[model samples]
Target: MAISIQIDRVSREYGPVKALDDVTLDIRAGEFFTLLGSSGCGKSSLLKLIGGFDRQTSGRVAFDGKDVGNLPANRRPVNTVFQSLALFPHMSVAQNVGYGLRLRGLSGSTLETRISGALDLVELSGFGQRDVNLLSGGQRQRVALARALVMEPGILLLDEPLTGLDERLRQQMRDEFGRLHKRTGATFILVTHNQDEALSLSDRMAVMHRGRIEQVDAPARFFEAPANAFVARFVGIDTLLRPERIVATGNHAEATIAGQTLPVRVEGPADLAASVVAIRPDRLFLAPQGMPPALTLMVVGTTFRGLHRDLKLAFSDGQTLVIAIEADADIGQLSAGQQVSVGLKPDAAVLISSAGLPPA
Candidate 1:
């Protein structure tokens, strides 16, 4: 019974400050969607509106095309797992999981069966009698999830649920979420400031900034075809070059930078005055000795990063870009202050508009 959500022209205002401004989005049923951004970006505000914890000053919030703006949190078929787990320390694992069900008139064998199923779903089947206070951090997280899932909510909202867990536990819980989503077939809406969490967990994600959605698409689209300069940097495309000249024809373009012309892949006719060339690290490599180099730049510095080494290459005009190579690759006298020939793969460089965009 997954529900599709439609947020039509939503705006949440707090006195004078607007938390969400004219935001509109549609989330498909059973889809794992994430709202990603830094703090004060209004992701949480929108979540509140959806969860019925807060109401919008303007616009509509609908579930399955039915407007539910007037519905209270308890009346709506939604469950939220907040950052602070808020599990009752006085209750046992079974008691905590069955609390909501019991309040809705479930009791005895039915309550027990529901509790057991929820615990089993979270992989905590045998720990029902254990005191919640005695559970480890990861176990506690599972308990919180089980509590939410026990009600069989159509929409599960995760509000930074993995915020304070250790790295190993975070990864473990992240996988668990994906598995549970499939098992329950609920529409999962996650709000996270961590890009890694959003990118890894979401089928599609929206990047929010300053109370607005900057871009919304599948995870790969954010990397392959970012809507603007802000999104390009957010998804880790760091080398944005202001090409001195660009010759465009269809999806292919030639961008001249530092007196070297390099092939660029473009989606459409690029605005030459407003666009910059984006160089993805995976598409850059050391030029072969026999082939013509795309650009010869000096190795300004190098840093060791375990599996690979990052070489900071600088052009004659002081523009710099970082490229990574395998740690054990042959360097043949490559060091700081030495010139190195670098080349770009076909369609590696992308022409993106640079208009009032922030640096990563």
Candidate 2:
């Protein structure tokens, strides 16, 4: 079964440099939680703290309300699956997975039963005698997972194990990982830098930056309403609205882009000059000027993007904008350098506060 975790005011220091700075979080029982961020972020450091592989410089970490900061790795009710899988190539799959049990002096029928159950849970049953090197990348990952699961830890930690696998194998392992989580009902804390992987798998995710968490929410909420400009950009938001081209008008702002005034909802604080605008590329639709709100942009370039065409447009001020057009849209004579009007519904454009954005 899964157990709840509470990390309060945690910080890890390497000399003067802080890898984790005053970070705190509550991971729910049986929840599939993910720590997502770019490289150099303190996500892995936080994971290490939870696994008891490293000690926190300050603050406390608790499992099911019991403080575990001083506990050794073997004493904690948690097991970690490292990125390298850590399986012994010379050992058989069963032997590699049972290595931990043997270390604890467990053997004979009971030990074999636990290993078999774990293998079945990861759908690697009957592959006990197979060499670790002979199995595929996805299978090797499953073996690693089984090894961790055999311990029956309350929480299972995975540190970007799929990063080393190829794209196809990664997807396969991702599906299997989901299934394994459901099967075992263990609280899983996955550490990954891939946004899509985190969004697709986790019940909720925390986006981290420079040892601090920017936002924590469900995937849809995180994408729809990012906490700040940094989260917005990191989450793959395409358009960046300059404050100079916008004017605040009550709850919304009037953006003068492509020589047309458009309504944009300014998010966060009320400073027009310091606030910004962000519109997702997929949210913008091609429409005529007579629409409720419209902007005419000169098409600078176009690229086919499977289901849609990505049109690069420029305004009179030389500012560029990109919008997506459905493949079936009317474009009999459309070409670069052509002027086209595009409009969106009132809720389409997102205005972000400059206060939350990182300093230039």
Candidate 3:
């Protein structure tokens, strides 16, 4: 059975420091939802609150509209697969997978059958007899997942479950986990700092900054249409351009960069006092033809990335912009300190609001 979860104004504090501040979110039934943020941003705290591992100071957490904030961790219908894997060193894979059920006093052939079934669900059917220490990192992770899955909890909280794995293993586990989610129909809430992992694995993601959620959206929309400066920056737009240069009428805006004014769409106005037009590296291009008379810049440097070349340019007025162009393009003709015209097509950039509130 699929279960839905609601987090209501959940706040957690450590002495005077607030880990989570008035946080509220609704996780859909059986959806793979991710809480994404940098460390100390309360992503883990929020996960802990949902797991019943931590209690909210002022708010409530509920399952399908029933309050669960006061319930103990064990009493909640949830299970967590921590980052450490936390498998007992001496135990075999089957022992670990059956630990929770065993704790509930289940044993013998029934336990054996359930453990075997859970192993199969994670695609590790025959590995139950293997020592956990003998399994590969990815296998151990699956074992941890199996342990959580076998419990048959309504919700599964995964805390950076792939943090230590190499890139290849991480990606493999990511795909496998998605498959597991589909097969089980259990709500999976994963927490991680890896943007790629969150974007790739989550059906929907919440981008958190400080102690609050900046925005929550499906992967495609979140990548293409960020809600704010923090989301834009954190979600992978690293370059910046002056916002005033962008003149907004409504859904559309024209930005003046170098000597050129290019049109773009503004999702909405932001609270930032300063705005910088943003673009992902892949959105930018290099053209042999000089930029329109309206745009001009001096090439500063270029770096070769296997798939593309990264170009750094500086406007005569001392502003800098970075653009990535095709690797085999005629970027070689451009050198340091050479003046060049730059242009941005309407679909190539986004306007991001800078920090609107002044530093206290």
Number of the top lDDT candidate = 1
TM-score rank order: 1, 3, 2
List lDDT for all candidates, in order: 0.88, 0.84, 0.82
**Number of clashing residue pairs, candidate 1:** 0
Q: Per-residue lDDT tens digits of candidate 1, residues 275-317?
A: 8777887778999898888889998877788999878898877
Q: Rank the candidates by lDDT, best first.
A: 1, 2, 3
lDDT of 2 by residue, 1-360 (tens): 799999999999999989999999999999999999998899999999999999999999999999998899888889999988888889999998898888889999988998898888888999999999999888889999999989888999999988999999888888877887898899999999998789889999999999999888888876577677788888887666664577766876777654577777766554556666677787777786577547777888878889988788887778777888876767665677888777776566777766456454
Q: Estimate each model's TM-score.
A: 0.95, 0.90, 0.91
Query: Which residue ranges in model 1 land beyond 4 Å of their true spot?
Result: 267-269, 355-360
Clash number for each model:
0, 0, 7
User: Which scores higher on TM-score, 1 or 3?
Assistant: 1
Off by over 4 Å in 2: 103-105, 245-259, 289-293, 327-332, 355-360
Off by over 4 Å in 3: 257-259, 270-274, 290-294, 356-360
The 10-residue segment with the lowest total lDDT in model 2: 351-360
**RMSD (CA, Å), each prediction:** 1.9, 2.5, 2.5
Error of 3 at 359 (Å): 7.9
